[model samples]
Target: MAGTLQFDLVSPERRLASVVASEVQIPGADGDLTAMEGHAPTITTLRPGVLKVVSTEGAKSYVVTGGFAEISATSVSVLAERAVPVEELNATLMDQLIADASEATAVAVDKDAADKAMADLVAMRAAAGF
Candidate 1:
């Protein structure tokens, strides 16, 4: 792995991925963060969004909702609450979720729930190129 970074994605249910790649893009709470082989050692909270993994092989996208990311000199480890491939995402379901979350927000019951729903919607939209 001379020029590549080792990346792993784990969830409560299972270990989703382990890859050696040249770059990785994560959806951090603040924004998107890209990592390479010599990235500084750091830890950050992942927002509900898509994690893009890129390499000479190809590119893969995963929807990750809430997680912690650890970046080091040689590796990046992500422990996610939930994760699924972009292709499997259901837009209709997400649209319904957005509507329900908006209703919740309007009622002022759970703002956090609204935020998470918005994040998920944003991630899905981005993943779908819309």
Candidate 2:
């Protein structure tokens, strides 16, 4: 595992994934970034998008609503606000998510909240290939 890093994706409910991975794609608040073994240590806030994990076992993708990631030379830990495995995603679920986001956006009390909700909707749509 010299070229691999421990990656863990945790949500409020439970841990979603814990494995050794070659690379992980994260949706940083500023942008997307990829983490690999020997990467510089850093912390980043996450945006709503897909988190892709690549390892010897193959690739797996997860849809994250928002979160934070702590990256280190040998580990990447993701604390997600909400996450769902891509395998469980479907057009119907995507539509529901979009609709729920739209409602949240409409009810947002402030411009920042509204913007965030809108962005989440956009990201969810993109991830769902809508």
Candidate 3:
């Protein structure tokens, strides 16, 4: 078996996950990356996408709007602006998320990031069909 690392994900609402995982797939602002045991220490901003955690127990996924990930050799910590388990996402929930993003985009001073985030949320909704 591959080496494991501690992984934790949290948002303002609650703590979503705390587990030991073989790997974690992150949706980085620049691109996608994977973190694993013995990985180099780094931090990156997260984009809107599914965050997948593969562990001894099984695979779990969460939808994150925006966030920061701190990856160290021993652990990966994610602090998200908003997050929801993939299983809990539905059309109603997705609609609200998109609407919220839209509102935020309209008022944002920096259009680049808001535009990118809005685009990603749309893509995520399309990909998930919700």
Q: Which candidate has the top score in lDDT? A: 3
State the lDDT at 68 in candidate 1.
Answer: 92
- Model 3 lowest lDDT segment of ten: 108-117
Model 2 regions lying over 4 Å from their true place:
99-130
Q: Give candidate 2's whole-model lDDT.
A: 0.84
Error of 3 at 24 (Å): 0.7
Q: Per-residue alpha-carbon lDDT of model 1 for 36-95, expressed as tens digits?
A: 988999899876667999866689888776679999989999998777777766877556
Report the C-alpha lDDT of model 3 over 1-130, residue by residue, as the tens digit: 5699999999999999999999999988878899999999999999777899999889999989878999999899999989999999999999888888898789877788788888888998998887
Candidate 2 lDDT score at position 51: 92
The alpha-carbon lDDT assigned to residue 22 of candidate 3 equals 95
Off by over 4 Å in 3: 107-113
2 versus 3: better TM-score goes to: 3
In candidate 3, the residue pairs with backbone N, CA or C atoms under 3 Å apart (3 or more residues apart, or in different chains) clash, namely none
What CA RMSD would candidate 1 show?
4.1
The Cα local distance difference test for each model comes to 0.77, 0.84, 0.91
Q: Which one is best on TM-score?
A: 3
Q: For candidate 1, what is the TM-score?
A: 0.75
